[model samples]
Target: MKVSCLIFFLFFSLFAVAQTTPTPKKKLVVVNSYTQYRAAIKSNPNNELVEIKKAIPGISLDIRYATKNNFMQQVMYKQARAFARKPVVESLKKIQKELNKKGYGLKIFDGYRPYAITVEFYKKASDKNFVANPAKGSKHNRGCAVDLTLINLKTGKELEMPTPYDSFSAAAAAKYEKVSPEAKKNRNFLISIMAKYRMNVLENEWWHYDFADWKNYDLMDIPFEKL
Candidate 1:
């Protein structure tokens, strides 16, 4: 019958459209399992998360998230530790050596953040521009980013920067020119030194740097204790 043929044609058309339309992608790959993390390092040594302190004994750590000093105003990390991928640590080692020769050294604030903590940051952050969206993950989650500043090697005092770490102010931008001359000089020096070691600065954060090969690592949710 003509009615039956029309229904069949409509069904065929609907099925063809469904088949052609792409399905939504799976949720972003977040390596949360300790077992999976171990597997990853086993497969590629580069994936190993190296503790910054152990690797560079001379490096200073403030670890704000481990105390109540960060923007969160609550302890987010159980331990005051910093970490990065093996190559990233190596680059820091070289940069530290270079800085030490200049009577300067690196002071770490944060590194190798867990993806879960990033999600927590996004949920409560008043300035979304400063926080990473959980939907895409963060370079810090991949152990390929670091938050740091320069320090006086002899006096052990932090160099004056454009703005304090985790400042929501516009002056936190790496290239912001309205800062004092001394602060601008220190900020530019830090940026240039970090760039020399393949650590590129984040546009809006004077102290944040991402390793050139960040894409090689997967977003990780494994905590500090496991690393």
Candidate 2:
């Protein structure tokens, strides 16, 4: 009887220890060195980050993170520039041409975010669903994601969207049905056009798109200044 109690106590102690022990975090490889980025470009020219505005003529930029108007309510980026991988930028250039023919233009909001900025976003973001977790990294950190909206080429006015950039509301969803007809039309048009060029919309974000080949690139911590 005493031996049985001892075994039971030992088993209970072992179970308690197992329950208290934290699971080990998965290791993430983030390329933080400028030289490493350069070497990557050398190995695969497609890995090069290309400035969107420079690659696409007449592209408009309203980098919200550069100003205090973003969801953060604080300036998150020093420069108001946008970038993407070589193929991604090439696709954007083609998309701009296609949009221009229809009297529309592309307005860039954010692109090629540094991994460090993603960590900051995860830390301060009130709604965890809207921000990328630093542990997994963001496609923006890989230069394979873009936040943009459509605009009238002639008047340079933004088309109506379901919700404003980074709204973090259910209405911000790409397929949300509660928005106005005009907003839904514009949102679907933007998604369709981007999709045609290998950029697919985030299900919860009307203005955000992820390049189909985003996994080809590594998460990078290289800042805009370094790039």
Candidate 3:
């Protein structure tokens, strides 16, 4: 009968539509297991994460995530330590030497963040623009980004920058022009020196820098304790 034929066609069409619907694709690949991380380093020594302070002695650390001073206003990291990929730390060593000679030193606020922490930041951040989405892991999770500032070698006082570290305001923009001459000069100087060592500043954060070869690294979720 015509009625039976119509019902069968409708059922067929619905089945076709269901079959053609695509499954959502995973947007990120994170190395979450220590065994996996160890395998990665074994395959490529460059993947090894190096502790920054041990590699560059005298490097200052004010790890905010380990305290309640960061934008989250909650302690996110258990340890106040910083690490980066082998080559990244090497570049920091060179940058530190260069800055130290000029009566300045690098003060690290963060480096090589765990991917899970980045996800937590995205979930809790009031200003989403300032936080990396969990769908796309952060460069810091790849052990190829650093959050830092310049400090006077003698006084250990941080230099005047356009905005403080992890500032979610417009003034934190790397190229924001509406700042004091001293702030602008110091900001640009920091950018230039970091560039010379293959570390480029993030457009929206004056203190955040991504190593040039970041794409070569894998997003990681290993904790500082494991490293």
Candidate with top lDDT is 1
| Each model's Cα RMSD | 3.8, 3.8, 4.6
Where is model 2 more than 4 Å wrong at Cα?
Answer: 1-26
lDDT of 2 at 154: 84
**Model 3 TM-score relative to the real fold:** 0.89
Output the worst ten-in-a-row residue range by lDDT, candidate 3: 23-32
Shift in Å, residue 25, candidate 1? 3.3
- Tell me, by TM-score, which candidate is best: 1
Instruction: Write down the lDDT that model 3 would get.
Output: 0.95
Clashing pairs in 1: none
- Tens digits of per-residue lDDT for model 2, 1-227: 99999999999999999999999988999999999999999999999999888888589999999999999999999898899999999999999999999999999999999999999999999999999999899999999999999999889999999898889889999999998999999999999999999999999999999999999899999889987
Candidate 1 runs further than 4 Å off: 1-23
Reference-based TM-score of each model:
0.90, 0.89, 0.89
**Model 3: colliding residue pairs:** none
In model 1, state the lDDT of residue 89: 100
The CA lDDT at 223 in model 3 is 94
**Per-residue C-alpha lDDT of model 1 across residues 1-227, encoded as one tens digit per residue:** 99999999999999999999999988799998999989998999999999999999999999999999889899999999999999999999999999999999999999999999999999999999999999999999999999999999999999999899999999999899999999999999999999999999999999999999999999999999887
